[model samples]
Target: MRVALGDFLELNLRVRSADDARLQTIFGFWPAFLVAFALRLVGLFKFPFLDEEDRMMRVAVNGLFGYGPQSGQAPFWENLLFRTPLSNSQAITPLWWWTEYVARLVVKDETLSARLPALLTGLIGLALFYWLARQLFPFPIPALLAWLLAVHDVFLWVGTKAQYVESFIFALSVLIAWALLVAQGKWRPFVVAVLASTTAMGFFLLKGMTLTFNALAVGVAQTALLRGGGRRLNFETIVQRAIFAGLIVTPLAVWLLAAQAYITAHYQVRVAELGYFRGIADILYALTFGYGTGRTASLV
Candidate 1:
C-alpha cells in the first residue's frame, strides 16, 4: 500500500473522528452534557434551603463562629468537621464562605447565594473535565470519559444543585487536574509551582485540607518524576518546592490564627475538652459510613 503520507494522516484523523462519534452515540453524549448542565439549572430559584448550607453562609457573613452555641449540633455532627481547640466550631473554608458572602451581596436568599457558585463551578468543571480528559488521554476515550461523568448520578447531584462545599471543591479539582496534566509536559517546574500553589491556596480557602492533602500527594508524585533518578534535586528545585509549600500553607495559617483570635474575642470562650483529633475521627466516620454531608453516629 504505497499511500501518500498526506492521505495516511487524513485517514487517521477521520478514523479518530468516527471513533469519537460512535462513542458519543453509545453514551448519549451531547444530549447528556447539555441536559445535565440544563438540569442543574432547572428550578434554580425553587430549590429549597438545605441544612449545613446555612452554616457555611454564616461563616461568610458572620465571620468564624468557632466555639459557639452550635455545640451538640449538626454542622459538627453530620459533615466531616475539623476542630482547632474549640468546643463549638464553624471554621469552614474561606473560598465558599467568601463566595457566598459576595453572592449574598447580589442574591439576597440563603439557598441561591450558597448554591450559585456551586452551579456555576459544576458546569465549569464539566467543560473542563472534557478538556482535561483530552489532555490526559487520547481521543474517543477522553470523549467517552467526559460524557460518562456528565450523567454520573452521584457526582452530578453533588456538583450541581446539592450546594455542598463539594461544588467548588469539584471545580478546583478539575483545575488542579488540568494543571497536573500540563505539568507532565513542557511546563517548567516554576510554572507548575505557581499553578499548584495558587490552586491549593484557593482550595484551602474554600474547603479544609482534605483536597489540599490530595494536591500535596500529587505534587510528591510529580517531584519524583521531575527528579527522574538522574541526580539529586538541586537547590533551585528545592526552593521551588519550598515556595510552593509556603504558598499553600501560609494563607491557611494566617487565616486560622486571625479567625481563631477573632472568634475568641467575639464569642464565648471555646473549650478544647472535646479534642480536635476526636472531631477529625468523627468526621472521618461520618464521611466513610454516614451520609456524604450529614451527621451520623455510625462509628461514634
Candidate 2:
C-alpha cells in the first residue's frame, strides 16, 4: 500500500528535525525495533502450540491439503473464509487459516508452517510498534518502551503466537491511530487520510466488534486532542472526511455482505469463534498480568 507507506513516511517528516535527528542516535528507533523483533523470535517454534493454534492448524491443513467434496473441507480461495474441516465453530477465525495455509506451501512441517504467520506478523508489529511509539512519544522513550514491550510477557507469550490476531490487530490499531492524528492536522494529507481509513477497514475485517471499540476510543481521542487544534472544520472538511471514511468502509462492508451470504448458504451454524472472545481475554490478561506473553517455561 503506497498510501500506507506514505503515511508512515509523512509521520517522520511531520516531526521536527531535532526530534527526527534523535531517531538517528545510538539507541535509535530502528535499533529498538530490531532488538524487540529478535526478542520476540526467541520461542518462535519452541513452545507447543496453544489450543487456538491447534484449531487453526487443523483448518489450515484441511484447506491446503484436503481434496474432494467428501473430504468435507472447503478450499481457502473459493469456498472457505470461516468454515473449518473439523467443525463450524472453527470458521469464525478466517484470516489466520488463510495465512497458515500460505505458509504451509513451502514449509512441510504442518505445525511450524501454520505458525509462520504469527511469528512474521509479530516481527513486523514489533517494528511498527517502534515507529508508532516514536510518532507519539519523544526520542529514546520509544526505543526504551519498545525494549520493555519486547521482554513483556504480555507480548512475548500470547501476542506473538501464530493463531492469535491481536498482534496484527494491535499494530494495525496503532497505524490507524497514527494516521488519524496525522489527518486531524490542518494540512490533511490525502495519503494519511487514506491510510487511516484503510487501516480502519482492515482492522474491522479482522474483527468487527473488536475494531468497533478500538476505533471509537481512538477516534474520539484523536478528534478531541488533535482536531481543530489547528484549523476550524468546514463543510468541505466534513465532506472530505466522510468521503474518506466511505472509501475505507464500503469495500469491506461489501465483502462481508458476500461473505455472510456464502457462509449462511454453505455453513448455516453461525459460530462466532468459540475461542475468539477467550483469545481476546488472554491477550488482555497478558497485558495486565504479564503472563503467557512468552514461553510458559520462562517469564524473562
Instruction: Specify the highest-TM-score model's number.
Output: 2
User: What TM-score does candidate 1 get on C-alpha atoms?
Assistant: 0.64
Clashes of 2: 7
TM-score of 2: 0.66
Task: Show where candidate 1 strays beyond 4 Å.
Answer: 1-30, 54-91, 160-163, 185-208, 225-232, 244-249, 263-300
Against the unseen true structure, what C-alpha lDDT does each candidate score?
0.54, 0.55
lDDT of 2 by residue, 112-227 (tens): 67556666766667777777776677665777777777677767765556655566666666666665554444434444545544553343232434455566676567666655
Supply the global lDDT for candidate 2.
Answer: 0.55
| Model 2 CA lDDT for position 179 | 59
**In model 1, which range of ten residues has the least summed lDDT?**
77-86
What digit string (tens of lDDT, one per residue) describes model 1 on residues 194-258?
A: 55445544444324345555666886787788679665666775676667657656765676565
Q: How many clashing residue pairs are found in candidate 1?
A: 7
How far is each candidate from the true structure, as Cα RMSD in Å? 7.5, 10.1
Give candidate 2's error at residue 283 in angstroms: 20
